[model samples]
Target: MKKPQKAIVTFTNPTVKERLKPHLYSMMIKPWRMIKNTLMLTGAFVWLLLLLVCLYFYSVLSKVPDLEKVPFQHVREVAVESVQSKIESKTKLKEYQWVGIDNVNRDLLYAIVMSEDGQFFSHKGVNWDALISAIGENIKRRELSYGASTISQQVSKNVYMRSNSKSFSRKLSELFTTRELEKHLSKNEILELYLNVAEFGPDIYGVKHASKYYFGKSPADINAAEGAFLAIMLPSPRKYHYSIFQNKHLAPRHQRKLRRIFSDMLYKEYISPNQYQSYLKWNYFFN
Candidate 1:
């Protein structure tokens, strides 16, 4: 009976901190955990994007052959828009020939460089100024009127793209391939390859074939006027070739364009005064 009476319990109130500690700690660290996870995700995404770009670059450049070792071809085939185009057009391919740099005259090279890209020798691949200007021009025109693609870019486009389709992906690939070309090949080599692959007429491809088809001479033997004519033909080869080959004379507008190219060549000191005079007076003719 005495032991039962002595049995008693004491009670104490708990503090606010002790009651709320676990919830408060979790609230404090929630934002930090979210931030850490977000950062990790962003980093992984960037790495994946870089890996895709590197793989694309390699894929674009892998198909190109070194001119110093193997000859490159301009694979030409006019896709006739017909139900039986493929079956009927078994041999729609045009002419293409690989010409070495040493076999081509320096004047022709200079003329092309002057007409296509004035800063061809200095710039690596892209010309920002001309490109910006072209972008502005195209925006104003509300059409893709201008392309400031360097000779290197043209080479990349002609070789890889195969068609004149101006898709955004094609342009991006051209940029990547142009840089790769600069890294792998010399300037002269790039020019040589371009001269060989560029479209000169509806059916003409490469300077070697172009020289013989248009002028009845080799590229090395082409004069300043002929070189300038060839340079101007680049923008619209089929459109420009309104000639005896196509059973029509050269358009007056094309002649004017050719003269303008000549003027540019002279102003840039790519040709002498006598050459300029000769370029102005010479008849724009092809064999």
Candidate 2:
């Protein structure tokens, strides 16, 4: 009876691992759970940020009103410089006259297409092949000397996103604006805007002013040789202008570019073999 009444119960402590099992399991699992949650949150944030960026780009591009009937305007950069030049020289320096694509010479159009963007009529807002080639060349040369800007991109740079500073952001903005422009404007309209806004000299803008200033003629009256000359001078108009006025000769570099333009024009059949030959022998108009 006594044995049955008093089986003195003795409590024994559990082993460390056994006693701490729940706490140890919690400690081990908490960090992993926390990491998983953090990763989830980070992924969500990243996706949200990407969505916001896409929305912003879309909004910006959408705000560009249709260009179907809007009057073309000069590049703000050119306008500013014109004003500055006028102020500094104490004389009128700005000259602009708009001309339709029909008013522009066919030769100049062909020359510009051949010289600047060979695929202007075919390509979209961007020329991926040229861009890739330019990238490879720049990488191999370890310099940023080459660009694959299409006519669309150039118009964007001239009109809305004019910045000489090199950066990825600027390029992206230019592409966006270029796409918008192409979406709203026809090829002929884009070409017209480009021709009308492009700078031909320090203050001369568009084919009208350039034609009168350089040759005392209208844009539609420009000859093949004259058109080629204008297209070649486009790369460095101000420099070539000074050189032509002062020395009556284009530098060797400009001469090379002019030859290249003529060669391209001939290759593309924009000019006949005889015309090409004639241009090859053509003298500089400045002299």
Candidate 3:
């Protein structure tokens, strides 16, 4: 018998080898790749649809202006009572006493602006510098140590959203509401809303009510020292307020820190030197 002839396969061109290699790979991997790509595309599409829905609702909600015609003082009362009850129940603490905002000292408002949000008037809805600084601080601390929320953002959160957890969805909602508020309200309006809605204690909402509950006065009537004290209470209402009230050691330090914030506000030109001096000389006697 003749020797068996051996059949050999070879590519005639280098390009053919390259082409065949890809074909072989496709035969092996195409199904998995296709499934992965299809799943990714589906997820992207779903996210886009959800974003559009949120935007649509936001636009519709923005068109509806706040129509509560009652004086802000009345709103302060309601907020105070509501917050007091909630705090008491949530913490199993004593009943938070209600105090109307009408008795609050006006100087306190200036103090708050000076301390918490010095650039409250100039920024539209966000302070990029503060946000950047806060981000940097968080990075350095390896934890959340600061916040960049503008006064308007805070109002949107305090009034409409629950102050419970910081989830992605809650943050998105806050951004949406803040953008809407910026479009519909002026700076002063936003500040007023914040002053009327912010939490001062376990249940105290708004400076007006907070003044009455803490200092036995209205926000408009608070003096510079009192205002500084109140401003000091803003960073962490639950922790600082209780510490200042109950822990004698913390009270002086807290007051001094508040005064420094006030001075910084003046130095930054957020508050006039005249306003700063007025508060500097005012004796802060709570009660």
Candidate 4:
């Protein structure tokens, strides 16, 4: 019988090898693809965790009560010490006094409204015109400039939350807290809260305390000139107060600015011209 024919194999054509090479390469890389997928999932989880943390803080800020409802004993003690430390370092001053809201002069409110937020009563939480103007000015000046934060917004910041550096995240948090505050409190209530908690000087926190520290009187007794002076100090109370008392040259300029702001209030029909002129001529003796 004839021997069985030996089995024979043929080589694949070049075209087939090329096509199969890709499939084989993909199979070889399957382990690496799994690792890559795992890493991507881990990254996504970390990002989600950060988002949850931010949301948690935002919720906490929104629910925080007004300054009166907050436990003053917890915050007031710390705030006093913090402010005192700043004053001692900056001005070498030691004396500090705390006064209540009822003792503050009402006239001072008008001055603050005129100087800080001209449209306090009319506008909502944000001042669009002032915000636009501030944005334009900052862009033109190419530097960080003043913003148009409303009294309500300031109250939210000072009482419920700390001031944040300018960033999208911080701004979103501010807006959330501000909206919550607006919903819970009336405009007048917000203003009252602000007056009760605002920092007037290094260690002087609140209108009542500032009144006694500066003018040796209650906030209710502060005259228009005194109100304007205090309003001027709002921008940089520590710096301006020192300048007014220590640097003779700066005192005149600060006085002039205060006069201009007081006059502007009259021009805007917020106060009487007689009142404006009276304050212009009134003598202010800083203590």
Candidate 5:
């Protein structure tokens, strides 16, 4: 009789098993869920990083103010820095002036256009052909030596960025700033600002100051020979400045650069065949 009573065992509830089914399924999928969550998080992080990079480039570009109508107080700020440096070093400060493009010598303009950026008028902010060529040359030379910096790019570096860094980040900043500058200013305006702010010698700033100091004449009064000489001196102002004083003539390198300028000018039809011949014949010391 006891063995027959033991045969009546309690059965599990079907509703309870149904309630536990979801929990069991979730446990089975736990690793896949973790993997999916991790992938989602990684994607979000990558998107966020891309957004930050774009924002950084935009911020750098936005710093270049609209120069269409604004008076270049930025030049004065840079001049003040130079003046402070001179005071700290106990050196006599050189003169700096903001001159209009009209006030500068035509020959000087031509020379700079030829020597520095032949396609200055046509290019937006970069010369892709020259840049590509420079890149090829650098690769061949196995050195980061070749430079294809346009006038606009130079202005961006001089005004917004430090000149000491030769990093990829610095170049990227320069490129962004140059695009901003081109968007805000005309080609002639860019040229005018560059002429006003470009460094000439140890303390000499601007073509106006350089012209007055070296030739004892205003930029407006300088001749082709003097203009070419000043333009040539731009590459190494301090060295050429002393050399001009000691030698009383242009160095061989300067002469070679002038010839290159003349050739460019002639090719661009900025000068006539007769003018090119005349320039070739003209000596830096004789005139």
Candidate 6:
């Protein structure tokens, strides 16, 4: 009788939904787990990349020479090693020249300050207004051709940066070093450093050397036109200077560019009307 009762036991079938509940939960949770893991990995990679960038920047900044040191303080016959290396590499000259700010003509100094940086004396390290305008100009042109570097920024680039350096990284380094320069050095000191490091001719470096190399005279004795001549060479010394110095002739295009720049210099009060007229007159003599 007990065996017969056991044979009558009923069988119950589970619903399809009930059977799929565990698998469905697993399917839903699987994608969430994968997404969470992917996000964690991406975060780790980003952090590592940022860390590498910081280390690289630190190494570059650490190598920068102290500004209060002997060579910088006393104004030696040659530029700092960083500057010297760049100049020598570019010019094929073994020496990096230097000159005192006192020895540089006011015309040359004013020309540089006005042409390169209109707010040299007023801005701290960066001329934000000029930089913003330059950025706008670059955006409009869709090219990074405009450099809104102040005297302090140029000095920092010459003294602490590589010649081949480019992009936003170069700008960031220049900004940091420029701020440091402005903190420790006066406007006059920054201008002095710029004059000593800037390339004025195809091979000429520093105001003193450029003066003697191109004009066969002292920088202190250069006329307004000569100063303007040197200022215009900054955009591309090789492009402009090779024609004037080697060919003994100024191109008509260069002359036109010079006239446009002179207008800006006059408006900025970098030169007087008389000086402007002198530069205009000097253009014909550039033959």
lDDT of 2 by residue, 1-287 (tens): 34557667999899998989999999999999999999999999999999999997776566443455554443334434433433332332445556778988899888877777888888878999999999999999998889988878877776665457567667777777787678767788778767766667776667787888888899899877888777766766788678764467777777787788888888888899999899888876534
Residues 36-55, model 1: lDDT tens digits? 99999999999999999999
TM-score of 2: 0.78
How do all the candidates rank in terms of lDDT, highest first? 5, 6, 2, 1, 4, 3
Deviation (Å) of 77 in candidate 4: 11
Q: How well does candidate 1 score on lDDT at residue 43?
A: 100
- Estimated TM-score per prediction? 0.66, 0.78, 0.63, 0.64, 0.74, 0.74
Name the regions of candidate 6 deviating beyond 4 angstroms.
Answer: 1-10, 15-20, 63-71, 74-97, 128-146, 268-271, 283-287
Decoy 4 TM-score against native: 0.64
lDDT of each: 0.73, 0.75, 0.68, 0.69, 0.76, 0.76
Q: In candidate 5, which residue ranges exceed 4 Å CA deviation?
A: 1-38, 51-55, 66-94, 136-143, 243-245, 248-253
Candidate 1 error regions (>4 Å): 1-95, 243-252, 285-287
Q: What lDDT tens digits, residue by residue, belong to model 6 across residues 1-287?
A: 45555556788898999999999999999999999999999999999999999998997677554566444464333345545655545544654456678988887887776667767888898989888999999999999988888878878777767664667777877788787778777788778888877887655778877777777788889876787778878878887677666776777876886677678778878788987887887742443
For candidate 5, the per-residue lDDT at 115 reads: 77
lDDT of 1 at 114: 78
User: How many residue pairs collide in each prediction?
Assistant: 0, 0, 17, 4, 0, 0
Write candidate 4's Cα lDDT for 164-280 as tens digits.
Answer: 577545655666667766765567666766675666766566676677777888777987677787777777877866776445334667767787778777777757878887877
Global CA lDDT of candidate 5, please? Answer: 0.76
Ranking by TM-score: 2, 6, 5, 1, 4, 3
* Poorest 10 consecutive residues by lDDT, candidate 4: 86-95
RMSD of 3: 8.7
TM-score of 1: 0.66
Report the error of model 4 at residue 34, Å.
23
Better of 1 and 3 by lDDT: 1
Which candidate's TM-score is highest? Answer: 2
**Superposition error at 40 for model 1 (Å):** 14
